[model samples]
Target: MKSFRRHTESHRTDSIGWLRAAVLGANDGIVSTASLLVGVAAAGASPGTLLVTGVAGLVAGAMSMAAGEYVSVYSQADTEAADLSRERSELEADPVAETRELTAIYVGRGLEPALAQQVATQLMAHDALGAHARDELGISEAFTAKPVQAALASAASFAVGAALPLGIAWLAPAASLMVWVGLTSLLFLALLGAVAARVGGASMAVGAWRVTFWGALAMVITAGVGRLFGAVV
Candidate 1:
């Protein structure tokens, strides 16, 4: 007889929480900082001034991302905690009702009534709170919020993404700083989108185009505004 091996496949759903924060942070970091630099350069700012603006943007943006991510995710965590607490209270107050509720949930999902009841009963026996939390409340470990992790990921990724444009602006010639920053920032945005899509099992082209289009539009608008204001001043 031959032995058979079973293989398990991993899905990106597990990465939904942190991946979203990281990608958003990085994308915003690149687009916003680059646009700011291009705008200032268009407004006749010196290279030293551009560098100062870029550095300031990088620091501010990273901290903002981190703080925003933490607060938003912490809100979610609080909601989940409240829900779990309510569920626990309900379970303690009325075990039969909780069991029936869980059983009904399983039955609604296509399980036979008797089998669902049995399964729910066994699960509750093993861990009533866990079973209710997982099934009745739709709260699972996979989607649990980690505020600290999200904040750290956002801050770090934002800093890294913002650095690319800052470095380019620093190295490129003053006369053509705008061009270099704009083009390189687009490249970075496209790359970020492609990599994020690939990691999430989506189309690379679509992601790349989506981000680049917005980035280009933002920079163009900012540069135009800068030129207009520079003329006025």
Candidate 2:
């Protein structure tokens, strides 16, 4: 049992699909919603309007994220399924040719001709599809995507992210709602960047600054537009 545990640990890859999705989703949720609120508030919109805009932005962003992720992942999933089907057909129709092809793949990878052929023969006899899937297609159980999972994750994270800004509008003073919201949102942005960087094994300073910079720019732009409108009115 201990040996099995150690073996699994050693095989662990630096990346995982769910972890990526979760980090991405949460970050999107926070940054996008915050920016939207800041922009609206800067325009000098009413508190009621800001709240409504925030809610609308959250819902719209969440749905869009989910739909986009679903379509993208579904396309990839379809491609993979097609490849697996074709491989299955090849396995049935002309296995000898397939074996030779697979053997050549092993040989190209650095094994000696005899060793490659022997390994290919044994692997094919055992589970040719799995071997090809790993070596040829680069698809493995660890990396295989789940469209539903990605879609849901992105949507859920967006909503959560948007919620922070919305909450600020509710709790902060209306007279200075934009200022408070902007400050709070930027804080969240920096924190999220740091946390995401940590999770992704990247430099925290770079990550935090990168996300915060975009978010700050977005808010500033929106505020500018709002000021112009407020001035004209």
Candidate 3:
């Protein structure tokens, strides 16, 4: 049972890597692009201008998402590498201290001191680096941070999310484009929220309605502002 459970957790750990960023990136793309379209449409822009704006938003947003993810993940990777190097040095210079350190970690985790020391001894015997990496440095292959992959995944997801609003704009009547875009985009936001919650092991209904409410409110406020400006002008 323990072995089986470990295997399941191992896989779950890997999925958490890209899955979190992908979902978030997609969510940003959807919300931002949708909001942008709603705002522009509310401004009573021409269909041609709206289409141009939507396309531009998609491209620019995707690039921005990808670049931002890459830079942020790169920093994490650098920090991990530095920590790993420090661990390696400590292991080489003072193996005894490192060993005691591992024992202390186990003790902190609720193990008896004698038992913790014993466990550390056994694990170090099998793989010293592995023991420290898991118990001290807190690094794992399953949870490795890959900057390039993260960046690409984020950008791709953002593009997918941004595309929804753009597609809505294309099909909508120019005269009523704002209304259709708002409604359709809100639907997408709700769906995205539910799906994200399901993937992240959260409450589906709450997630759906939360996103729906915020998205609707944003659209409404933007529309009102646009109408006010139009009336005043």
Q: Judged by TM-score, which candidate is best?
A: 1
Clashing pairs counted in every model: 0, 3, 0
Candidate 2 lDDT (Cα, 0 to 1): 0.84
Window of ten residues with lowest summed lDDT in model 1: 4-13
Among all candidates shown, the one with the greatest lDDT:
1
Candidate 1 lDDT over 48-96, as tens digits, reads: 9999999999999999999999999999999999999998899889999
lDDT of 3 by residue, 1-233 (tens): 45443353344456776887888788888788877888877777788988899899999999999999999999999998888888888888988888899999999999999999999989878888888988887888877789998998899999999999899999988888887888888889889889878877789999899988987887788778877776676
Colliding residue pairs in candidate 3: none
Worst 10 residues of 3 by lDDT: 3-12
Instruction: Quote each prediction's TM-score.
Output: 0.94, 0.88, 0.89
Q: How far out, in Å, is residue 99 in model 2?
A: 2.1
Q: What residue pairs are clashing in model 2?
A: 29-161, 30-161, 43-226
lDDT of 2 by residue, 45-127 (tens): 89999889889988999999999888988998899999989988888999899889988999999999999999999999999
* Candidate lDDT (C-alpha), each: 0.94, 0.84, 0.85
lDDT of 1: 0.94
